[model samples]
Target chain A: MTSSTERSERAGAPAFALPFRVGRALAFHELRERTRDRWVIVISALFALLASAVGLYGRSAEGNAAAITGPSLVTLASLFVPLVALALGYDAIVGERERNTLGLLLSMPVGRTEVIVGKFVGRALALCLAVGLGLGAAMLAAAPGEARTLAALLGPTMALGLAFVSVGLLVSTLVSRQSTAASVVVAIWFLFVFFYDLGLLAILVATEGAIGDELVSSLVVGNPTGLYRVSLLASLGGENALTDLGLDVSLPSASARGAIWCAWIFGPLALSAAALSRRALR
Target chain B: MQRLTLEDVAVRFGRIEALRGTSLELRAGEVFLLAGPNGAGKSTLIRVLLGLVAPTRGTLRVDGAPVRADRAFRARLGYLPESVAFSESSTGREVVSFFAAARGAPKKRIDEVLERVGLADARSRLVRGYSRGMRQRLGLAVALVAPCELLVLDEPTGGLDQDALTLLWSVLDEHRAAGCVVLLASHEIALLESRVDRLGLLARGQLVALGDPTSLRERAALPVRVKVAPRADADRDALVQALERVGTIAPVRGARALELDVQPSRLLELLDLDAAHRACIADLQIVPPPFDEVYRRLLSEAA
Candidate 1:
């Protein structure tokens, strides 16, 4: 007989792809594959060497661990970590689509949420490893005393990195072409990380310091990287820099910056996950 | 066993009707070959079965129940897309293992599927260096790793060398023997005409014809050709004269033989070489319209 009768007589149903294990598997797979990406590897190595050099140089120059990764490290990390995130994740979804591997990956019993979340988890793991190995070397090269400060600094940098990675994923889902995604990522990275503060500064100058403390605080918290930079002040750097930049207010406290960091970390990541899940495969 | 039934399924991409309302059934234990010209919506239909593309309207029921593309539902399917690719830096073994885990299939399947696709030796070689045929084999291995209620392969045979193709056919044959449905969309279906249980011809987003080879031949309404080959150096006219008794004869293209469009029923009689005809004719060949011709005629007719 044909299929209908045979299907009726089948003994058992097939096993499903459990979300936890599948997501974990995809995470690891993505991590392993990202290791092959020249950009990721370069950034990873770049962070490692830069952190170690800073730590060793600070050790010789000032003999203090805190001095090694202090305000300078925070500023440099603010500039570098987001680059790592965007460089690695800019093509997360659309890259697979271009390689034609997205269909293969999605054709399995795994869900769209699994793909996005698992990728983030994997990239996050890679981000931590890169930061830990790269910057960890620097801390180790210095006196063990500054481990506390380094931890504080790494936490927000990683959060900032994750925020950018999530934005990259959202860009991947929002566009079909890899070039477009990469371009969008560069524009976003430049605008928020490098140029937004300057644009805000220009506004401050044009208004003759009329931009009030509350307005400055809200504006800083608005851009993800800006939020990341604010989080940086709480990590290790002092808040006087914001005032000199014409903020005219005290730097945000640690708890408030923590909240902003959490928002920045989860906000884009969640939205991108939603976008990926809602977008049709075909 | 699985029964794939599409009831008036249609897909619209903005202004383009990629697939129109079309009803069809692919029963278990049959190799259903889907054939069509470019942009004929064959790929779209295949995607619908794989659950990659949802139908704009109508129902796709697997075993009498409407299904969505979910983990449980997709677990019952094996799909191989037209453009097969993998991480260039990953070894064949790593690539297979990654997919196996993603598929939730056992790690033990790694060895069996690799052996089946004849990639055991190249398992350690990175996919970047694999030749076209080897990569195609890897794709086949990925599809064969999981147990599937329905096997959906879009252009599965493209780029496969003879050895790889033979292995793929054997694997698919085994899949059919297990009573699972095998749906393939390939322009090269004519090459496996003898093995295809049913042929689906899609044109302009419509299923133009669906049948076994003989049924399609009947639907196509094309003639059967009978060729009478002469003994070496024998008179071609004598063979022609002999065939003229049954039907009008023409020269077999580039051969020392005479061809006739005799009724299929009378081919055996024409083949019987009695003493009178035996002197002129050495052998008789009956040629029916191949699937490719039938495919072209079906598309043109539908158009």
Candidate 2:
């Protein structure tokens, strides 16, 4: 029998020698799989073409002096950014578990943290590459002066995309099966992007301008997409343009600031990673 | 000897107690077969040991240290889940490599195990196209690639022909010779009888029996069959006393006149002695019940 001291030594055994390295290895494995998937390539091309068309249309309209305002572009980005995020992240966790690869990954020396974090990073990287392709296509589609617009919106757009992906990963872990998770994520998409905004509009109409100060600010802060839309508006319409447009374009709030916007994007991403890491494999 | 232990282990799914008050120890170089039918808690037990499921009420330890939170404990253990699945839509080679990377096996060893499992030629083909037997072989390859201290296999040979079964047994034999502790859970009793050194029979989350194969068969209390013809002044009472000393036996019934069922292997000595004295003038047969009867009888009686 082992002594108490020996028991303690074994109790304090280091997590593993290769959890992080293996996580990175898994990340690369995910990348290889993602890159080889015909769907990813197809979606990448589609997003690129779509972003390119939007960019070209914006540039042509600017030349003709019939352009959509900077705030309008923010609204436009809001429409599609969450779609991409939800589509990719929703299946990230549940699909692996459904396909039975999650068990294989969990059986390794690595902890649950590694598997979740690694997959998040891997999926995020795939999204980045896909969005980058879209941005490249946007660049080619730009006419003369729209390169500045693309540059200004690029980082913020990618950050918003990452935030959505994190949310999807979180939902994936929370649910059991792939089909159920996918369905819930889609419902979440409808609620957040479509219905929630519509409800907010109803609230705005009832409250009118009297309650706009505190309530409008709180609502915008609570919604990451609204915050991102506001940020993108500022990038397009000059810094003080949101203040000038009043609630018509975006709300003004203490937490609606740019730093808070960054936090909104990173918060869920961090939480999803944490949840995935800390939760045990079923 | 290194020991793997579970203390007051319990697993529950909502209100259902999949495993309750389950605790056992496995030692290095011992082939411990966990025999149970479906829903007998064998799968749940194996999952807990593999670190896939946390025990609701107790702790899991390796060498006397808690492994519930020990990630490295997994590295020392190799697992073959009941139904193996792979991502990347990969060929057999890629699937094996993924497991090798997870287990920290040497790059060269991956190829060796693939060849050992008879998947060397099919290594380049996508696993999506593999047959059930080939996939099972691949699963075995994954479990064998690493130098794990403990190997936990759930139905390792669930789908295999006799030839494929031989290949798996051979691989297990190699692991045995190398002194690896193997904990296998299977409903296939005939296969496990020869493969495992000890058999653990579980029913409704309780360990009803655990011992070497012969000991288990003996403890099962099911009579072993023996036949003999009637003899003149044959000390029938003495024969009955001698057989009763060995184990419980049935009365003389059916065609052969005097037929007794005793301990599986113990009857041989009595028969040998009787033959030496020129007693058994007919034929002999040893019939054993299928292993499931051990659980069927106990579970039913308990209920």
Candidate 3:
């Protein structure tokens, strides 16, 4: 029952505390909304179904079952992670704007950066949880020794989700309409998950070895999906499918791969914050 | 906050100017209303004050100390947008609590605000289940949940029913009584005329008139109307001749009556005529200039 005067005085208490509290409140609200919409459950179920099928299929096939399953899981995750991440984040900001809630939310004692970061944190957590549960279930169902490889694959899968979700947020900020943001998100997914590697391979074929292995390696490391595949494949000592395609895909060291993943996760998020700051919330 | 001032503030969206060098001040304990036609920049001005839109020129000051509308500055401000929306899946209580926590208000204040907005009974229901009026009430609950030095509401009465509108006015009164600066943009001029302390009429991004209702009416100097019904056997021609000398007279439809539009200065003379013609007039009623009339006149003048 603190009086409003007492509460008003607290406004000057600490700058850090207010943003942190506001960010946490916004994040929790986002998580609650997603949970109520069954987004977490649906995505988790989809991942579990797909991951189990991929795991069982890889176990029946080839040399070193664990190594095979690990790369196989990474491949599955690279495709699904971007799609799911984009779906979760495509309308994050634009949807609010469309619903006419962005202005009210912005009017609160919350920073624009806090809004973007809070949403990212919330969706990232949901993504990690859903993917973790699905992959965890798959790992448990795997043969005893293969569980380690699946476990090792889980972190990179979540990182890949973070990277793509950040990209989705950037799209949400740039577009004014929710439908446009959604369309752009789909385009981004297609470009990254499918067309990117196809275009790279097309370049190799088109150039006829004019593009050196060093340059192709740099290109591979540039895309989040490519980095996820190379880093996990290199760490698990599994041969890459791209290498098998006669591309001579040399993977960067684990640390460089990790650093690039960090950049992927944060770069678009920074841009989104900048875009939101410049936006007229009305 | 004793005084919040917008010093010659102008906001431009690309080549189009939304607000043009408009200066205004809102003092504590006063309910200031912004009235304007569509595209008159009422909403834009509100956004600028909320810090959602930065002014392309000029400054915003709180109590004579210039400040940016950052989170710290907005900390003491409460706002309800023209259309208040929340997640359909969230319950009334959850929505209120989310905003309350974001504003750093105590948790107990959530229920208090819900009760204040008459949503306590519906607190557990999802927003999707709430009626539009209920949704507006929930929006008001969120805005009022935290204590604020300045409360800004845009079109707050849009979806509100009579009961909710009455509740809103009462809550606004409480805020004003508590020395909160209540700034609202609304088209409910007639309803708000008596309640608001001052009115700013914006036409084409300019404040055409700024004063309380009485002063605004005086400034507009629009004519007042007097409706008169003549006796059955009275000489209507003679009554019209006397009324015409005082003011312009027009026939009242479907009645043996005449409507007189007279300037305020001539109202006493018209009333004296009505008194002299009481034998011929069965009824006479004087209608003062309404707030709507003043608003229309001011806007037309500015246009």
Candidate 4:
């Protein structure tokens, strides 16, 4: 039976031409290989568990039983998104170079651009899967309360998580060593999650709140994590009340905002690809 | 036809000239061996061919077309790098498939190559568990599966047992038999001497010597030394004349050593006949200078 199947397969030529297949195949292979990491699985599961616990606790505290509101979902994302994105992307390109496999990959009928883009995409998909699984648990914890609200929040949050992943990939290309890549990625994470807000608060204190709404909006856009927070908040609830805050919180039109976020996503990818091609193999 | 050519190809890492105005060509189906000491720009030359490093000057072409990083250009090469490491998490089979898939390989080719490299049973084993030799074989397997017209391998047999070496040789033979051109960079002269058809010696980033193995061996100009006891009235002039007739000969006085330049192929012929000649010979040793010596002398001349 196997022999017959082999014969039939041999008789049927490959449908896709080699290059496109290679790009997709490499992407898929990485997706599977990285998914097998026990740490990734454990941390993702634990994060999901924590999200469930938080959602449940929040639901109990509120009198009305809605799955999760804009603030709670944003809170959950703010806590865990950077951790996952940094972990996934920190070792992407540098790890391959250190392993001596970069030459092997580059020598084949594959483009450095394809490799850079494909790996980032593949790893982004893996991060999405893990985040999706965790978010599913978080949604369940918001169950019987605000399931609709929790569902509403997932779309924009994942997109924001994806942007963080791209930034991680960019840093990986710049750093040669895996440990160094990890350090820089973790540092970026700290700046976004903890430092950006603190620094903003300090700036507000120093200027006697001279930084008005306009500067605040630009600063939020510059901070990847802060942009994610505002975008997620806006996506989940139609009430754009977050825009009125003293933190320079004006959301641009969706199209303009989408372009800004897309740049955040693809801008790093393009820059990293250039850096990778120009890198000396040594 | 010149299947591969490098014209005045020069490369530099900062001020260090890794390859300097190197040029050579290999006809299809011929095995060209690159031999040089460490830091002689052999790796640089290979990188130029693979398009890994652009030359500081000169041009390289494969199959009469310029090589760039475009997909169509990369489609034509199979490279087996030295000390190729796999992702610590990938199985041997998956690693091969990943590379093959990167080139859009058919599934059957993957299994065929794995079996060809003698890693069929260990297909499921993670690459981290592989021994150095096993990784080398797996690397060979990856290089083989691609539909490449030319195989550019750098030090393909750096770390292998005799059995593994034999397998690698057979793999090379298979490719050559299939009319594939192979350009190998290596320092293992003995194994490559019998295997490769043409040899190119790269010294300090220049192509100093290039020819068949027989031609290289002949070019060494090894000298044969003979110590003859002086017979009271032996025809010393005739003796010198007789040795000269056999080949180029000169005399060193203190030990009465007569040196005749001879190729290794003609050493035995001279030995058998010199014994028959009535010259009183005290001692004789056919001293063939080391390959390294010939290589260095050639580079010095080129410089």
- What are the DockQ scores of the candidates, in order? 0.46, 0.28, 0.52, 0.37
- Scoring the B chain of model 4 against the true B chain gives a TM-score of 0.79
Worst 10 residues of 1 chain B by lDDT: B264-273
Q: Which candidate number would show the highest DockQ if scored against the true structure?
A: 3
List per-prediction Cα lDDT, in the order shown.
0.77, 0.71, 0.85, 0.75
TM-score of chain A, predicted model 4, versus the true chain A, to 2 decimals = 0.87
lDDT of 4 by residue, A1-282 (tens): 123234224324354344466668778887887698776677777778887786777677773323234466577677687678777777778887787777777776667788887888788888888778877786787647576667666666677777888888899899889999988987888888999889988998999889886887788776767877776666554445464433347777878777777888899889989998897665
Candidate 1 lDDT, B1-303, residue by residue in tens: 467789998998889998999889999989999888888889888777766787899897767887665666676778888878877989998988887777666777888889888999999999999998888889888887767778888788878888877887787789789888898888886787876789888988899999898888777776678776788878767667667777667555676667788756566666465676677777778888676777888878997
Q: Against the hidden reference, what TM-scores do the models get?
A: 0.91, 0.82, 0.94, 0.84
Ten residues in a row with the worst lDDT in model 3 chain A?
Answer: A10-19
Q: Against the correct fold, how does model 4 do in TM-score?
A: 0.84
Candidate 2, residue B135: the lDDT equals 88
TM-score of 2: 0.82
* Candidate 4: pairs in clash: A65-A145, A66-A145, A66-A146, A67-A145, A67-A146, A67-A147
Docking class of 2: acceptable
**For model 1, what share of native contacts is present?**
0.59
TM-score of chain B of each: 0.91, 0.81, 0.96, 0.79
Q: Name the top lDDT candidate.
A: 3
Instruction: Name the 10 consecutive residues with the lowest summed lDDT in model 4 chain B.
Output: B221-230
- As for TM-score, the candidate ahead, 1 or 3, is 3
